[model samples]
Target chain A: MAAFIIANGAAAMGDDVTMFFTFWGLNALRKPENIKVKKSFLQGMFGKMMPRGADKLGISKMNFGGMGAAMMKTVMKQQNVTTLPELIQTAKEQDIKMIACTMSMDVMGIREEELIDGLEFAGVATYLGEADEANVNLFI
Target chain B: MAAFIIANGAAAMGDDVTMFFTFWGLNALRKPENIKVKKSFLQGMFGKMMPRGADKLGISKMNFGGMGAAMMKTVMKQQNVTTLPELIQTAKEQDIKMIACTMSMDVMGIREEELIDGLEFAGVATYLGEADEANVNLFI
Candidate 1:
């Protein structure tokens, strides 16, 4: 959510932005029904237990059985603030470059088709190239 | 470590930076000997389990009983990369403003004296006030 918000804000300010999604971060871009992975028995359990999509993601702290996430969503709606999905949509609309880590995808058993449309697939070297030229590089 | 590295990098590039230390983040600023907290049984247990200082912090992923953290630290040293403590010290030297959330401090039972010197105390409103005027705002 923080990454999406910051990317949206930066893009809104006319700055070029690229979001490099790696490892668990790629889960945000996964299609709800396509969010399953089974690298190992433990990892499969983690995948099943964790939230599926961006909207379903819970807060890192004080997430009481997803109640905190629900409450936060409600508050965001009330405050007219964009939710994670909406922010992601805005990011796409704003033409912010989205790249999924190919190596991470391979390790996590995530296929390109399972992710949302209009994303580039790249590796860490690609990310390093971008970050090398970026004035503000963030790893969220 | 990502936060500190980015902050240090930004500061090196001459960008004005302010790090808002809130919730679990305040742990990085804690003096190793003064990291104890007894607010509640649960909170105290958390304090006991968590790393005491910046140098002791474990990796977010694959942190096998702090083995990952120690290994990473060793690799960082070999690569001549700045360690977390060194990064924090660099942040101080670079004059990056470090703000501790007063409300978080109260909740976590962290006192001002327990934190490193040269820090400001503020709440969310204060963070917002600075973020409002800044061209780039990150919540890490």
Candidate 2:
């Protein structure tokens, strides 16, 4: 969410933004529905254990099971702050480059079909290349 | 540890590196000895609860109390990998700029005397300025 907030803010200011998702961050780009795919037992377990999408992700701190996330959503609605899902939509509309790390995807058993549309699949080398070109690069 | 590894690697390659520590990351730069300092009730509680130094931090995953970190250290030793403290020392020798966030220091009630020697204190704007001047900027 912090990464998206930064990306959205930068994009709003007319700066080109790219978000590289790796490891657990791949959860943010996952489709909500479970997509059937063949995988090793360990990978399958990992897939099942991880959250399905942005809406399902738990906060980094003070997340008492799912209740904390629910309370946060309620407060966000009250304060008129954009929800995570809405922020993701705005990011898409802004044409922010969202890249999913292929190595992480393979390790986590996440397939292309299991993720949302409009994401480039690549590895760390591609990320390094982008980082070298960009004025600012952040790993969140 | 990942951040330190990257910093050490970059510094080893003769790249200018600056490490900006904020929030819990400040713990790594702390002195192992308890430093007497005045603080508000909440701040005192926060200071006491957090780990003291690099040696005190638990691993991000499967840290069954402190056992996981101990196990990791054992493995690193067996593999002839440099320890976290050694990595930090190398970073200092390489002259990697280490900056602790002053705002976070205030929030966590961490006095300047509580931290190790050789550190610059600054806030987010300083970090942004440094980031803007660099070819690669990462928030880890």
Candidate 3:
């Protein structure tokens, strides 16, 4: 579903969008970088790990806050808006190509040498090159 | 910042983009129709009443989420990406013309007849007219 929104949005602008997922979103591509665990002291003490990977990081369409996102979801459910997870899954199923950022890996002690397979690395040039062709671009 | 991004992005595609915010993002607009309380059970049950308009509903880029928001934020911050709030504020400060989404406003029981001053309202046709001429039309 995340892919679907991204791919569709990028496609809507008719531009080539290259998502450079550093940290966790890179999980989808198995890029060498893993997101730093911003552990709460409590969670850290308990050794409770957060969800990992791009697969887990790509959020849904509804925003979270205030009523803690329930309002958006309630309205969406009432209005029949698609769920974020569904959109991410749909994007993947639709074959949206994603790229992982390499710089973040090096910054976070993630080893491109040890990154998961099925992923490739490209630097700012790669992102800029693609952005040059993109009519629209978004970080999230 | 939003205007800079939008102008640059739209111009990148040689398109004129109209950024219309409804719900929470509209808070910057100062329209009468956009004064709502984003109350929860406690707030709703105990706080004073507020408008359920666009300003309160629009979200800031720094802390937005749908599904896998946590990882996305970490990656974005690490990547040095700017948040949407900054983008919107930049747009406002830079004099970028922003339109509020009237459909969303009305659905939220907003009084379009009483929207904050300086805002223009038309249907999707308004956006469509601009979008039609635009080589790239964007939702963000």
Q: DockQ of each model against the real complex?
A: 0.07, 0.20, 0.09
List TM-score per model, in order.
0.56, 0.60, 0.47
Name the candidate, 1 or 3, with the larger DockQ value.
3
Interface RMSD after interface superposition, each candidate: 7.7, 5.8, 7.0
CAPRI band of model 2? incorrect
Which runs in model 2 stand beyond 4 Å of their true positions? B1-133
Could you say which candidate leads in TM-score? 2
lDDT of candidate 3 over B1-140, digit per residue (tens)? 34447664554454444665654344445443324545344323221233233324333354444334455545768998765445555454555556766655443334444454555665444554454456655454
Q: Which of the two candidates, 1 or 3, achieves a greater lDDT against the reference? A: 1
Cα error, residue A45 of model 2, in Å, equals: 1.1
TM-score of candidate 2 relative to the true fold? 0.60
TM-score of 3: 0.47
lDDT for each residue of candidate 1 in A35-54, tens digit (9 for 90 to 100): 44435543343455445678
Per residue, candidate 2 scores C-alpha lDDT tens digits across A23-99 of 67899889999899987665676677778999998888888877898999999999999988899999999999999
lDDT (10s digit) by residue, model 1, range B16-50: 88999998899899888854434677666666676
Q: Can you tell me the DockQ of model 2? A: 0.20
